[model samples]
Target: MERKMIRISGKRQITIPQKYFDLLGFDTEAECILRGNELVIRPVSERSGGEFAEAILADLISQGYQGDELLSKFKETQKKVRPAVKTMIDEADALAATGGSTASLDDLFGTEER
Candidate 1:
């Protein structure tokens, strides 16, 4: 690939040439990455989109997981776990409302209680 120079505008933005954009098939929301001394541009098609869902469904079918059973298991796990997390967050909020310092582990764990 031949190196091409792009002039920076007053706002410090450089427009990518149309040839490069066309060659890469980059659409409006394409992502670019800068790694050390190299620049990498990636189109959305090269990324993992709904393909993960397809892969997961294939794996679940291969493992003999029925749709309703899988959903029920997920719901059961969420119901069991959410209450503990909510209680912890509520306790933290109560402590925060007391205007207590939370800057250190000792303060948070009540080690400095007078």
Candidate 2:
């Protein structure tokens, strides 16, 4: 285990140490949860892609994908999907900026209007 002391700046930003970054492989972003009187900083990991990976894996398995082949395929799929998702998010952001100060599900993701 490793330990370090950190100070919060006037802007309320604390820089996470490089030791922790190297150990955890988390970059730039984290989720801070206010638990009672204490603050819990958890890394926002994109490694697994969780639900997206699961859905893709299920579909691939149905098509006879498995083992190292499955892993390779999933990674390849990730490379392809990430950019498209980013584009959509960029478009959503631009739309939101022009329309309002916020992006809603219906405007950004084409969900049912509320």
Most accurate candidate by lDDT: 2
lDDT of 1 by residue, 1-114 (tens): 667899989998777788888997988766677899997767756333333455445555666777798666444444544454446556666778886555454444435322
In candidate 2, which residue ranges exceed 4 Å CA deviation?
A: 1-48, 100-114
Model 1 residue 45 CA deviation in Å: 3.8
- TM-score for candidate 2: 0.45
Clashes of each: 0, 0
What is the per-residue lDDT of model 2 for residues 81-103, given as tens digits with 9 covering 90 to 100?
Answer: 66667677788868976876575
RMSD of each: 12.1, 7.4
TM-score, candidate number 1: 0.43
Q: What is the lDDT of residue 64 in candidate 2?
A: 92
Instruction: Mark the regions of model 1 whose C-alpha exceeds 4 Å error after superposition.
Output: 46-54, 65-114
> Best candidate per TM-score, number?
2
